[model samples]
Target: MASKVCVFTGSRSDFDRLYWICLEIQKTEGLELQLIAGNMHLSPEYGLTINAIRETGLHVDAEVDMLVSSATSVGTAKTVGLGTLSLAETFNRLQPDIILVLGDRFELLSVASACTCMTIPMAHIGGGQTTEGAMDEQIRHMVTKASHLHFVANEMFGQRLKNMGEEVWRVFITGSPSIDSLMRTPKITTEDLSKELGLDLARPTALVAYHPATLDPLNLEAHTNQFIEALSQFEGQLVLTYPNGDPGSEYIIKSFQKLDAAHGDRSVLIPTLGITRFVSALLHVDFMIGNSSSALIEAPTFNLPAVNVGDRQKGRLASSNVISCAQDSASILRAMQEAMALGKSPCGKPYGDGKASPSIVSALKSTLEKRTRQQLLTKKFSIPGEDK
Candidate 1:
């Protein structure tokens, strides 16, 4: 009998990260793939990205309606509550053997919590990563504790999972599936992407994908002001995409609109760029700007220069292509200069080679075939140097 593998994708952001893994599962001989999408994917305000998922060859088994259209932290919490209620039922109906979850979104918190309560063994990808500037840092670790199988992007992350009391045999360093998705997904030529987004590829270009700092959104407007001040002077053809669904995304979206409203032809705001288009943008753009993790994990694969704004991505591993900056205009301008200077040069990317999908699929199948649910759920915490 095929092992049932259900993948939960809450937004456009994590969906891309999980794409290849889903496809790999669907193709493998003994793995049945199931997909459940919710949150920003179902919201028109977030570009109704569920349609994009439908366009993908893989089928979406279910859609959960859990996103509250509030731009405050309270709404985020309520979304979690709703998600747990809905996902509990969803899990009951599908009853997948293992749930594959990626990243550290608030929606994922609900998914993890519900999975834990239901006694479903979870395979968590992107665990053990830290972005201390946001609450995701804590949530990622929490998901780590809840999950039974850990698929990380690097040995460092696998070790971190081990440090968190995860048994060593349960951790697999499968790297990141970003490169696999980017390489396998049908490419949109630079010209077609340019026409689709109404930006000229002939000129210097930068792709901006900023997200709100969930940890400190009190000064969101101030951050927006700083972003506006920096982009206002940029000479490149800018392709700015919508942010993740979080508190203060309204302010961040407004900042993008403000730039488009003022600059006209110089910049364009794309509410949603699906994974294919986004991967295209990564390839063609000379530089990237924003706090989105793709700037660190995926961009370096193309040797693209990325200006990481503020401390949102403070603690993640990065390559030389990433230039750090404060949200202030002066610092942004300085980092922009450095990013341009660095250009697209070959740099060592820590997120593994372009073959993470097979490794992840193999791990999923091997673990499931060898270990029973009760055995997988059993965990033993061990200190690194306790014996010594």
Candidate 2:
């Protein structure tokens, strides 16, 4: 019988990055794929991304609804607790041989904790990367410590995992699976983009996908207001996507509504653009303005200039195309001006060459074959300077 591999997707963004890996697992023999959908994907306020998953024809083995509607720190903490309780139940029922989790969301961390207690080995992706402006930085590290197998985006990240006492044999540098989607998906045309967004794509346009800085909770509103003020200086159409389901997201959403209302025809606000449409929009937009990881990781794939405002993406690796600035309006405007001045340019491949899914699948297969459940559960701490 094939080994059952359970994949957990908490948000649309995580699903997008993990889609190809799931597809590969489904096609490969001796691997039974079980998908557990939860968190923002189940919430209607977050674009009901579960439907998007269904449309892809992937079977969802279970659905765990644990997101709290409240956007406060206390609410987020409670949601994580609820998610852990619910996931424990789900794992008990599913009894998957291996659980695969991606990224550093609190929900994913909850799942990792449940898996660890359940004695179910987990495979984690996007480990060892830093996001200093948000709590995800710590969550990512915690997940890495819990996971038995690691698939990182780059060698530097893999080294970081090894430095954290993870055995070097278990860490694999698989680049980023999101870049695989960007390379394989066909670009959406200008006519189609213009028709869908109801904006003239002939002129200069900017795609904005900012999320709240979870670390700077007190200054969320102030930072968002400053960002909006900076965006007002731009002359072309501004297309904004809704923020992620983090604490203070409500404040960012309200700011986006106000910007849409104020700009009218000059700005468009979309609750969610999905992944394909988002990548297509990247191809058409003159530049990207936001602190979204996509701006730093995926935008450069299209040679798109991204004006990354605020410290939300503080410690991630970025290309020459990414222009970083403070949260203030004047600094953001200046950064945007600099990005526009660069115009269209070629970007170096700091992420990968768009082939991460296959590598991840291979690593999963090999690791499972090499280690039993008990062996994977028995982890030893490695000192930073210890000889191999």
Best by TM-score: 2
TM-score of each: 0.97, 0.98
Deviating ranges (above 4 Å) for candidate 2: 384-388
> Model 2: per-residue lDDT, tens digit, 266-363?
88999998887898898998999998999988998999999988888999999989999988999998988898888779977688889999999988
Q: Cα deviation in Å at residue 376, candidate 2?
A: 1.0
Give Cα-based local distance difference scores for all models: 0.89, 0.90
> Which pairs clash inside model 1?
none
Model 1: per-residue Cα lDDT over 1-388, one tens digit each: 9999999999887888788888889889999998999998999998998998888777889999999998789999999999999999999999999999988888989999899999999989898788988988988998899999988999899888888878888999988887787778788898998889888887888898888988878767788788878888888878988888788988888778878998878788889888889888888988999899999999998999999998889999999889998889899988988988888999988998879889999988999999998999887786677762
**Candidate 2: lDDT over CA atoms?**
0.90
- The top-ranked prediction according to lDDT is 2
Cα RMSD, each candidate: 1.3, 1.0
